[model samples]
Structure formats: C-alpha cells, structure tokens
Target: MGRHDFFSKYAPRPGRLRFAVSRVAVLALVIIVLGWIAISILIAPPPSNEPLATVPLESVPTSSQSAKGSASPSGPRVTVHVVGAVKKPGVYELPEGSRITDAVKSAGGLAEDAHPELVNLAAKLIDGQQIILPGDSTQSQNPNLPAPSNNAKISINTADAQTLQELPGIGPALAERIIDFRTENGPFSSVEELDAVSGIGPAMLEKLADLVVP
Candidate 1:
C-alpha cells in the first residue's frame, strides 16, 4: 500500500492518545541518556597529580673542583726570612703554596727605594727562601765605591747571614744554619755538602753552586 494511504487508514483517533504517548516515550529516552552522561562525568575521580620536571641551571667545573680538592690533606709549614731595605725585616711563617711577594708583605713591605727588579715577586716561595730588599744606591757609581766586581761578588764562606740570604733560594734561616754548620762542621768541603744540612737538597745545591765557594 502507498505510505499516504496507510497513514490515513491507521491514523490514531484523538481520544485514543497513541501519538501523544509515542512522542512522550522518545522524550524520556533523550533525558535518560543526558542524565547518564552527566553522572559519569561527576562520579569519576580527578586525574592524579603529576610530578614537575626539573633541570640544573649550571654545573661546577670538574678540573677546578679536583684542583681545590687535593689528594693529600695537608703539607709542611715553613718560615722564610726577609731582610735588608724592606720596611721591617724578619722571619715570616708561610704555607707551602705562598709566594715571595707574600713573604715580603708579611715582613712589612719593600723599602721606599727597594730594587724590585732584583727579586722575582711571583716566584713560588719554597721553604726557607729569603727575600732581600737591596739598598737604594746599589745602582750608582762613585770613585769611593768599592769595586763594581766586589758589589756583584757574594762569598758564601765569609759572608754574614744577611749576605747569604741574598743568594737565590736561600733564606735567613738557611743562612744562619749554614753559618752554624760552618762554625761546627768546618767550611763546607765542597758546595755539594750544603745538601747535608737539614733543609737543602740537590735542587737547592744546584741553585747555590754558582753562588758558593770552597
């Protein structure tokens, strides 16, 4: 049968209320689906809190850290003597890594006319390194002056502690010890014997060979 013919023949009577009931049933199904969706959303737990990601801003230099963190815990402490044209001259205690300038500063700074050129200020101070401040007039010339050669010449055999301290790498304490050794043990048989003294060694003897005498 044609759709129009069928609908006309089976159309609900107004008093029967069949069309109204069918519309109400579809509306109920839509409301039920909406309610179920809303309940599912409200009843589910909120998503778990997540840990934050982090990154370091900077890292320390490995070389520098290792350098500062020395393998050995500590080392010997030594004192060096500073004398002559310095403002105040005397013995100064120093750690192994201290420098010549550090010792000079401890002795109260260089004299007004100290010869800075004669000594290496940056040299790493070894145990017993004496730093001397030379006289202002050392560079001058006068007939009354002793031979220029004499001024340049340093005699370890007869020179006092102050003079001996002027030698490279020799400090006032070592100079005094040398003098004492000379007094007690007799003049060094050869410059090499200086190593037999407590603080000196092959390296120091090499530095002193040119400056020492029989």
Candidate 2:
C-alpha cells in the first residue's frame, strides 16, 4: 500500500508524537545557547597580552649615594718641602689636602738622625710650607758651623725646596716651582734666571741675587 493511504487508514502511534516534540525542543535550545555565546563575545573582547614597563630595584641608585659620589673634589695640587734629616730632602707635589707626613715620605723618609720631636708631622701641608728637622743641621753649608745652623747662604741649584725657602719671600710652593724648573731645564745658569719663575719679579730677583748661587 501507498504511504499516504497506509497513514490515513492506520492510527499513528502515541510515542512518535512525543519523540518529534522532544527533538524540536532540543534543537531550539542548542540554537539559543549558540546565539547567547556570540552576543557575549561581541560585547566583551579579550585583553591585550603586552607586558608592563618596570625598572629593577638594583638598577636605581639612592639619592644619598648619588650625592656622595658627586660631592668628591679632584685636582688642585699643592707643593710642599721636606727637609733636614730626611733621606732625600726635596720639593714634592702633593694634593691640596696632604699632610706633613705625606711630604716627608715623598722626600724618601726621615734619616736616623732626624729629630721627630721638633716638627709636626700630622699638620696639614700648605703651598709653601717647609719641615726643618732639628738634628739635620749637618746639611748646613758648613758642617763645622754646627747643627741647626742657617747662617750660610743656600745654593739655589744645589739646595732642596726647604733650603730655598730661606730666601726672602720664597715659600715652599715657589721653592718647589724653582726646583721643578731647574730639573726640567737643567740648573739655573745664574741668579738672573729667577725671573723665569712666575712669582719672582725684578724686585724679588734683586733680593734673591745676593742670597742664591747658580
């Protein structure tokens, strides 16, 4: 028999109607769920995956530390003379903040006969300061004159920075400069060469003329 004629002649089963209704309901529910998901995605998008910028603690310097580093002063050197019983008495270039002990070391340290009690080793050195050791009088031009004597005229070229300071108006700084000039350009040929040193003007040269020997 034909399907239309069979269906029309036979009564439909009660279970078939229920099965069709349940299938339709399930499909409608799935469609509704899918639409809801699509709407949510359109409303709220995913966040970007970029990282935040951050400086490491170790890389950053503290305010006090940076200030301390910048606070230090450099350069600005001064000259000082170490004389008397030092092993090698001479003029020495030193930092502006240097002390007498530092200048003494540069002059090759004190000799055994040095009178450590006379001079202040801990004192701060100045541009033209001299350290005269009491027992070092043997260095005087005339050994027979006695120790601690300055009566003999100092030889400009042969004298150390300390001895040169004996000249009028000549200090440790000027004495050092003179020695440095002498070392670089050989000994001063005559007292007239004193003019080459910046601080020694005509009047100073005249005063030093009778005192120093080339």
Candidate 3:
C-alpha cells in the first residue's frame, strides 16, 4: 500500500481530535487541584485535644503585711501598784524582768521628800507587787532611833523600818514593805501573817520565825 493511503486511513477526524484533546486537558486540571488539596491536609498539624495555655496571675505584698513581718517581737509584761513619794503613784504596766528602779522611774521618779536610800532599787519586780517609798514623815520621826540588838526578838507591829531591817534577809525595801503592810492591814495576829506582805515568802518567813514577833 502507498504511504499517503495509509495516512489517510489511520488519521482521526479534526472534530474528534479536538474533542479528545479538550477532555484530556480537563481531566489533568481536576487531578492537579485534587493533589494540591491532599498535600495541604497532610502537611498541616493535627488538632489538639488539650486546652489553650492561660496566663498566670501575680500578687504584690501590701505595706501592712511587710511591716508585720519586719516588726520586732515583744515579751511578757507585769502589772504593779506604786504608791508614796513618786510623782505619779498608781497602777502601772511594765515589761517582765523589770526592777524596783524601773518601777520608780515609771512612776516619774522619787519626790523631793522621798528617801531613795531606804529601798533596794536593784531588786527584781514581780506581778501585782506593791512598792512603798518611805516619806519624810517616817524618816524624820525615827532618824536617830537605834536598831534593836541581834539576840532580841523584834516586835513586828511596833518596830520601825530600821528595827525591821535587823532581821535576816530583810533589806531596807522589805522593811518599808513590812511597815506599810502593818499600817494598812492592822497589827498582824500571827507571825504567819507576814506571808501576806509583798516580797515576803515562805523562805523569808522561815528565816524570821525566831527573830520576829507579831
């Protein structure tokens, strides 16, 4: 067979050729769009099941709170009654471990007529204690009186502060306390009544048992 004849018989029609080429172009476009969508879905991250992270809240300390933390600690306190010769004699509150000197100062110190030498200022103070200062009246009246003899039994009711000081363990301060106690509560009925006096305890009473009389 001739070449031209073979070509003519095998070649497709123009209308059919155009239709086939359009169909192939449309199919290629659809495939390209579908491939792009699939690639985007695979490359993207998976959806998270956990909740979103939240910001934390911060607080600043207040002025009062800071002051409370920085303040110094305080110790226990004692209450006492001060009377006679001080500028302001009344009940007062003082810190624990305070001494007789501190109590006197708290009461505005000694008066002009106060005999400061008649008390033991260095003695430690106790709660609910009463301090009595010997005024000019008590001192001037018995300034020249002599202390009783060591072997004699002093009368607690009638003896002055100087005589009371002769007892064992009795200082000027304690002597004044004895005088004030008897003056306010009346003459003691028994030697045991000495226990009621401030600063006089069982030990002091025992020491004075043989040396003093009610």
Best of the candidates, lDDT: 3
Rank order (by TM-score, best first) = 3, 2, 1
- Top-TM-score structure, candidate number: 3
Model 3, 123: alpha-carbon shift in Å? 0.9
lDDT score for candidate 1 against the true structure? 0.67
lDDT of 3 by residue, 1-214 (tens): 8999999999999999999999999999999999999999999999999999999887677999889988988889988787667888989989998877899999999988776554556655656666665566534554332222335456575555666787888899999998888767765656789999999999989988777655
**How much lDDT does each candidate structure score?**
0.67, 0.70, 0.75
Candidate 2 stretches greater than 4 Å from native? 1-6, 9-58, 79-93, 97-101, 106-108, 115-214
Model 3 clashing-pair count = 0
Using lDDT as the yardstick, the better of models 2 and 3 is 3
Poorest 10 consecutive residues by lDDT, candidate 2: 142-151
On a 0 to 100 scale, what is the lDDT of residue 77 in model 3?
93
Q: Which digits, one per residue and each the tens of the lDDT, describe model 1 over residues 1-214?
A: 8999999889878866877888899999999999999999999999878877788678666987878886687677767777656787888888877767787888888888665544446655545544554555533522221222322444344455676788888888888887777667754445677888878988988887665553
The TM-score measured for candidate 3 stands at 0.40
Decide which is better by TM-score, 2 or 3. Answer: 3
Residue pairs in clash, model 2: 128-172, 128-173, 137-148
- Pairwise TM-score winner, candidates 1 and 2: 2
